[model samples]
Target: MSKNTLINILFLGSILFIMKLTIFPQESLGIGSDSGGINLVPFRTSGYIFLHETFIKFIINILGNIILFLPFGLFLTMRFKKINRLWKCIVFGSIFSISIEIVQLSIPNRWTDVDDVILNTLGTAIGYAIYKIIDKKKMYLQED
Candidate 1:
């Protein structure tokens, strides 16, 4: 969109990136305690549906993760208009998530989860989709 919007997005993105990095610092040597190591816990859809605790946990986990990096995707798309394309947005988002994962793998007290990568990418994609929808609405209103 506009230069002012891009600038604002960049400013926000920088703040978010710094905050996230600070909260989840990278490992010192690319490996950390076994207790905090990455775990490939499969999301149990049945548990999500059947058990009250599992259902609440699943909802919380999904929503929390989705909300975390939403700003990253939003700012990325808003700053780089070229990222409006779905494939480009996804690629950049995936790379960004991967970088965060790699950093987490190195840091102590932080565990690198593949599920986080997936959820983060999904958040990015959802942000892009939201932007697209908003843009389209603006265009339609303008035309009308």
Candidate 2:
């Protein structure tokens, strides 16, 4: 397959993985509830997790959100030249994250948190930085 086709496939798979983790419910996860939860204040959930929750839970809640969306920014930049700027990646990431949080509001036992959007956007920015660094290295090597 061509490079572009491969990237597209990978991106689609990543998106599905994200949806499964965020939207799909699994009873085994102990997340049973009749309705979802919402946290509008920034960092409230994260702060609570950090202060009261276990270290592992904190990592899963905070870092996982960011890592979960890193591929999104990378794939977007790779697939679309129009999203070449870091700010564009951040904006797109925020929109995507906000959409997911909004959807989570309807799913039982799921949570809608502003922190997730912040972390996810940070992840997008990190991904964009990684891409730019790699691209710069490639250009430098090619000129050598």
Best model per lDDT: 2
Pairs of residues at least 3 apart in sequence or in different chains that clash in candidate 1: 26-107, 27-106, 27-107
142 in model 1: Cα distance from truth in Å?
A: 0.8
Give TM per candidate: 0.72, 0.91
lDDT per residue (tens digit) for residues 42-113 in model 1: 444324434655666677567666766676777778778777687887888778777777777666677667
Cand. 2 Cα-lDDT: 0.84
lDDT of 2 by residue, 1-144 (tens): 999999899788768877887788756654434466888999998999899989888988777888888888788788788998988999988998899889888777788889989998998888788888888999999999
Instruction: Report clashes for each candidate as comma-separated counts.
Output: 3, 0
- Ten contiguous residues with the weakest lDDT in model 1: 25-34
